[model samples]
Target chain A: MVKCGLEIHQQLATKKLFCECNSELSEEILYKFERVLRPTQSELGEIDRAALEESLKKRRFIYEVTPNSCLVEADEEPPHELNREALEIALKIALMLHAKIVDEIHVMRKIVIDGSNTSGFQRTALIAVDGYIDTFFGRVRIPTICLEEEAARKIEEKDGGVVYRLDRLGIPLVEISTSPDMKNGEQVKEVAERI
Target chain B: MDTLRSKHIYKVKILSPNMEVEPGDLVEVKTKKGTFRGILMPKHEFSDENIIVLKLDNGYNIGLIPEEIKCIKKGIRRKKKSLYKFEKKDLPQISIISTGGTIASYIDYKTGAVHPALTAEDLIFSAPEIEEEANIKAFVLFNILSEDMNPLYWIQLARKIKDELKESHGVVIPHGTDTMSYTSAALSFMFSKLSGPVILVGAQRSSDRPSSDAYMNLISAVRVAKSDLGEVAVVMHATTSDDHCFIHRGTRVRKMHTSRRDAFKSVNSQPLGEVRGNKVIFYEGYRKVEEDVELYDKLDEKVSLIYYYPGMSGELMTRMLEGMDGAIIMGTGLGHISNEMIPLLKDFIRDGGVVGMSSQCIHGRVNLNVYSTGRKLKKIGVIPLEDMLPEVAYVKLMWLLGNFERDEVIKLLPQNLRGEISARRMIIW
Candidate 1:
């Protein structure tokens, strides 16, 4: 197995990950939203393992948005057109990685179990795919480019809204997983740095 | 995997009825190595020895040695009854645009975590300290922490605060400590002429924790809100011991530690007053709440903070300033920088982009007159924020930009507002 993966996270310079909301943490209660899981019927009609597990738990997520960090979290309102600045930054990073940028971008959902993401799933989209970077020893082939919503930072484990550190939430991050082509830890580190 | 199968099964003997382990009751189990507290799941049936199993907070099961066990205390389980009675007081209408932090928080059961318990009643109940001061009308504008706080929230909060200031006695904001100073500073500038006090309060510990400062901070903030001080100020623990609380000017405070009761400090300036018990004793001079206060509800969010380090490139500064309206440089000792970057700094200033310097050391004032680098920065028109924290400088810059022109902001950068900049250095070096 040529197991190679890329792991990455980039800060979305925009005020928040995807909205005009200021992502921050505080002791003040801003707006409180309660959410319950409503499973989306997939095309295959088979729910993914993670989503099924979460659905079974019957978890209720109470998402909190401060005055500075507002209702964009509820999905009650569509994000103020994906933060163009963050998108541009992601594109720039993808280009630097020698990846091919996709002509169009479509936001997709990726399930998260740890409750870091208030929406139960993260909003992610592929900006580019199939790229490579130069290394001292050889060329490292990069596969897949993804732009995703950063998860809510966990603040404290309590009853209603799990106190998530808002500072890290909605900060656009870039994650790149690679195939396991490297035989040793040094190669993994090298490829990680190159990406 | 093997560790799970061969997990140490200590024999636990419940010697006293006081130590009875019920199936679902929470218990504090003591061991030779350490103490573990969790809900008692059940007794292991397969084991020949009488061992008790506990579901640890982290979701792991531990079996205790019955013979080697010393003691077990069933925890004081208090059934949570709603502590609030719905009493709508006909008090002056005030808008509480809650930008979410820990203010409306409680311990969650299913996930065994802590989260924001954000009903209006929950918020009020979490901090009963507010009842002594004013009747509150709240609006949860957003659910976010201070670190994630951005310009939009600040602007929205300012608008909400401005609208309420006309009718309310005061506005109290519960915010996160990490970036409370930044938000406070932003509000201070946005509501430059705010007549009623806009007090931003936050707790170092979660409300669920025994030592949490949420209650005290809220109480003090309410007092500050109702006080004669009409400015944006942060109310937080004055010291680690929590004996007193201090009222910090919005543009002068910063979170000094990640976790501490007294996390916020007035960088380079003294706090406006100290709140002991229920009294706000003003110890320093402050801007008097002016009548018909003009609210500046605008922000230039493009501004960024450029922290300088040894051998930092001019390219980084240039990139950040390329299209930025303002920049705050957290510079080295006495506000010095690599002289190589002086030309870029000068150009940045000339480009109509405001550049201000704050000491990274955070304790003392920034004086550009002592060294050549300082002189270079001064020549470049890099206004040194004598003793203001970096976050405060950023907020002040954003606020000045909202109402004043670039040139005017450059001139006003060093001027004191709400004690953000100190006129005289305390001479610590």
Candidate 2:
């Protein structure tokens, strides 16, 4: 017997979540840059636990840029306004899930320092919460649904450092996390397939 | 009307017989219209004797002359929680001057609005840790909102700060965030030399709020006040978190966002410093304490600021520059008005109405050498102010017109004073 949970990551059909970069991935590298990441303080005035753990390794990261990459991808500029198309798509999914939509969407940064993010943080926002889907086995609860920017795609490793391409860093990604209430792997598979 | 109960500003005749009522008591009242229940409110001195104020359920206050009342019972007593505390110790003497903003304001229950509520001592004692940072001397100059702040008020405040700095090591002004950068720029130009730091601070949220930025800002300001810097700076949150506060130079900072905690940002330059826990970290570019203040508090009120918009009529342009000693034009990119407005501006300049050109684009310097229209404006005697914020340039023009002659105002408008203009071009923010 196994207790199972499902976390579905779905890519949206829109422009990059922040900047106006296109969603197409290219292999031809235009430029490359190297960066060292440091953790930032959260709203609670404390460094995030996972971010601290990543900081302990103290490694460098190199990013290969594509034609679509701009100053925002290199972390030389601030991110642009959120893509409205991506937001609407996520909102529609949350509505279909019968979830309770939040009154205000507050974008928060989740620290990720393993060379995936240039700013050492992942931008995410809670779109909805507390909805459940009925299955033949039981009711699998959907604890949260979030909209986030996808991490940079990992490439080859060089000199004990991880390299990532900038093409995938700002793409819109939706996360649907379900509770570990499914008693069997088959029930989990059913919930995943149906959702 | 019991004289012993001084809280009762109304007549005893208004009350029911054998009934005692106090402010903060829960009471159910009835009149010819209907029944009402709310917490009893203290009578204001200006209120009529027959009227009684009550705070209703929807966070509104209503005044009524009741016909009958019942249940003078106690309401839910709330104990105010102290957010921060510290033991008083020997510290640098700092003067905190309150000019009425969210920092020292409290909710006026009578009107359901925030009012300037704290005295000097009340301000310091609100967050006791501020006392631990500095031996504070608080003075509330006035309680007006920042929008009402004028050039004359800046003059008066400068005079007060000079007087305070003689006795205190430094001064911190709690002001309204709106138009705060203008005041800082005004004060920066008014004082050439200073004995100590003159720091201005404001909060986006009120002090009564648990998430109020006031507590951290006040403490950080007090700490920065005790530092060795002599220039006027605006201190606000470095980030949205409760981590630390950045010290922005008065001439370079602007309120970039409407209501964010880190709204005050240094426009073209980096901040002078930041204050973290138990530490005031100074950055590269900051001035040190000087001997004493050489106060030049004069300001010509006739100088006007005009922004050039597309399709602006010549009549409007002429009217904006008419009857003014000088004008600061917030021009388009590279500091250019339409080709038509240039001739009118030339006439204005020919008539001794000094005009200075500043960019509407908030960041980057104005370059008259790059564009043709810019060169035309320059040839017509429009002084191009470099890299200076339009608002700062406007304030500086007023200050220059007041202190100097006509020729000097023109000559000095392009020159850098009070770190208003950056010398070198920068690629990064």
Candidate 3:
């Protein structure tokens, strides 16, 4: 009774998710700043119990900014329009898998309190849902495919504090999640490749 | 003699002329299209003059050119939802002044129309947390979008806030965000001093939406109204997320974004402070509550704000500044227009027009000494408003012309009044 699912994250070779910042990193640090991140409630005005618990820790995060990031990653500027290339890539993948593209793509904010996102949340959008990939062993149902921005790269932790690099904070990433239909690890790997 | 019949603004000729149906009246109408029974909705300004609107029981609105109308009832009584009931307590006595915007609006279940909530009870009902924090008193100044805001209304509003401050601990103004900063800046220049804080609050989203910052901003503004600050300031979301609210000085703040929750930012200066939970924090470089209020509620409405563009013709510039007593030009970097336009501006200044220079950059100070064109502008009597926003400069010039003589206004245009002109500039984006 071994049930398995596959979730694969692939970064799109495109501009940053919400701004015109480059996806490529720089060797020299442009600026460094300190910020304190807290968890936010959902649109329904209900705080997730887990996020509320994490917010109680009250962690201070230091962000090492580079040329790859701008005011957007610094959480100083509002987000621009979504990246078209990254969106097209996700749509193309979903269409190839025969997934039903959502009538309205809702770019949702996922609350993240780990100080990895400068805005204290990760932006994601559901591209498609309810598609399937047939493996040699069984039929693996592709539950959802989402387009999301990558979290900041964790540089190090010092004095019980976390330091993150803003360079990778906004790079667009495609996540394809499968249902728990795979029977074994080999079939899960096969299904992931097919997607 | 009917109490409700003559009170309605709907004078549609198509409806039975003898039968006058007022808004909130439950009427059954028979038309060429079909028979409809619903509550007569209030006449919106934008609706056709000949047609009547109705809100059906299904909560949808419909407009029709009716043939005949029969009143089923004189008026429909509204069943009020559970609202925050005010109980007498020893909290800070704060006044909530509604100026009619999305912040102070609610859907009438009877007619399905959104009416501007104009009382302290409406405010507390929306954000119930304020009931325990403050003993609220409320009134409405007017119901107009801030885009339609004018110098005349600013004067009246200044007088009103001044009067309210005499009794309440502070005053909270719920205004439209389109020109909230403009009104804030005008009030900042008008009220030289205040006995308590005057906080202007607005919502990016209407109150009907779940994620609207209306109640949160109102609650935070009530907290700020009870604080130790005495400046006329704006309290809005400090971030896009619903974390806290920033208390931005009326003279220093600007609406940076169109519709984001964190649109209003303290440009060229740090925010005065912020409101976090129940704890109101005050930062450095802010005015505290004074002993007495200094009132200067006069403003010259004959001022124009012109945005100077590349290759802008002198004819257009002259036309723009033709009847203006004063003009604030949103100029290029370092506050410069074309050399050709400079002579026209000089002529305008010579012919009794006070032209002030404020950069369109919006973040930095206007330094008229760096470039030759700027020096020419300075020589031609263009007042350089260092770090003052173009809109603020426009309103400030208007206030100066209204209160002072020509000689005194020219002397005081560049001087620091109500922190409009910061002595030093900061590198802010």
Q: On residues B232-290, what C-alpha lDDT tens digit does candidate 3 reach at each position? A: 99999998556689999999889888767789999888888998877889889788899
* Winner by lDDT between candidate 2 and candidate 1: 2
Worst 10 residues of 1 chain A by lDDT: A38-47
lDDT tens readout by residue for model 2, B244-275: 89999999999987666788999989899999
Models 1 onward score TM values of: 0.55, 0.62, 0.65
User: How many angstroms is residue A3 displaced in model 1 relative to the true structure, after the best TM-score fit?
Assistant: 62
DockQ of structure 1: 0.01
Name every residue pair that clashes in candidate 3: none
Model 3 chain B: lowest-lDDT 10 consecutive positions: B1-10
DockQ per model, Cα: 0.01, 0.03, 0.03
> lDDT score of model 1?
0.66
Encode model 1's per-residue lDDT on A1-195: one tens digit a residue: 344555666565566757787645556666554433333222113335565445535544555555555445543333556777778888888889878664345554454545566444577777766677766656667666677777775656665435454445676777775544565566677877766
Per-candidate alpha-carbon RMSD to the true structure:
22.9, 12.2, 10.7
Colliding pairs, model 2: B1-B12
